[model samples]
Target: MSHEFTVETGLVAFSVGGRAQFGWLDLVTGSFHSEADGQCINDAIVAVEFSSDVVH
Candidate 1:
C-alpha cells in the first residue's frame, strides 16, 4: 500500500512495507529516494543530532 502527503510545492508518497520497510518519493525530482528496513529514518535522526551537538 501507499500513502501520500500534501506538501507546499507538490505531493510526497511513501510505499508501505511489512513491519518497518518503507520507501519515499522525491517530489521535486520525481524519484524514489530510499527504502528503509527501519534504519534509514533512525540514521537520519542521528545525523541531525550530531550536526546540532555543537553549542554556539
Candidate 2:
C-alpha cells in the first residue's frame, strides 16, 4: 500500500514496492514517475542514502 511519517518539522511519505523501484509522485510544477534498481545510480552521492529520491 502506502506509508506516511510525521516528524517534528514536517511529514514524509513512502511507497513500498516488491521490486527495488517504486514511486507514485505528483508535484505542483509537474508530475512524473520514478524508480530505483537497488544499485548506485550516481557518483556524486557519498555517505548518504535515500529510500526514495523522486524527481519531477
Candidate 3:
C-alpha cells in the first residue's frame, strides 16, 4: 500500500502591530526598516521574510 499527502503554504507576520509595514524597497536602496518597532531591523531582509502560518 502507498499513501500520498500534500502541503499548503501561507504568509505569516514576522513583525507585530504596525511593524508589519515595510518601507519602500528599491534596487538602489540597500537598506530597509520598519517605521513602527524596527523589529529585526539589522537582520537580513530575506531571513525574516516568512514566518510560516502552518504549524508544521
Question: Which candidate number maximizes TM-score?
Answer: 1
What TM value does model 3 have? 0.24
The per-prediction CA RMSD against the true structure, in angstroms, equals 12.9, 13.9, 12.2
Total backbone clashes of candidate 2, pairs 3 or more residues apart or in separate chains: 0
Clashes of each: 0, 0, 0
User: lDDT score of model 2?
Assistant: 0.28
lDDT of 3 by residue, 1-56 (tens): 29542212222223433334443222244444443453434443341344445555
Which portions of model 3 miss their true places by more than 4 Å?
1-27, 37-40, 47-56
lDDT of 1 by residue, 8-42 (tens): 22112233432322344345644443333312332
In terms of lDDT, the poorest run of 10 residues in model 2 is: 6-15
Summing lDDT over every window of 10 consecutive residues in candidate 3, give the lowest-scoring window: 5-14
The clash number for model 3 is 0
lDDT of each: 0.31, 0.28, 0.36
| Candidate 2 C-alpha error for residue 19, in Å | 12
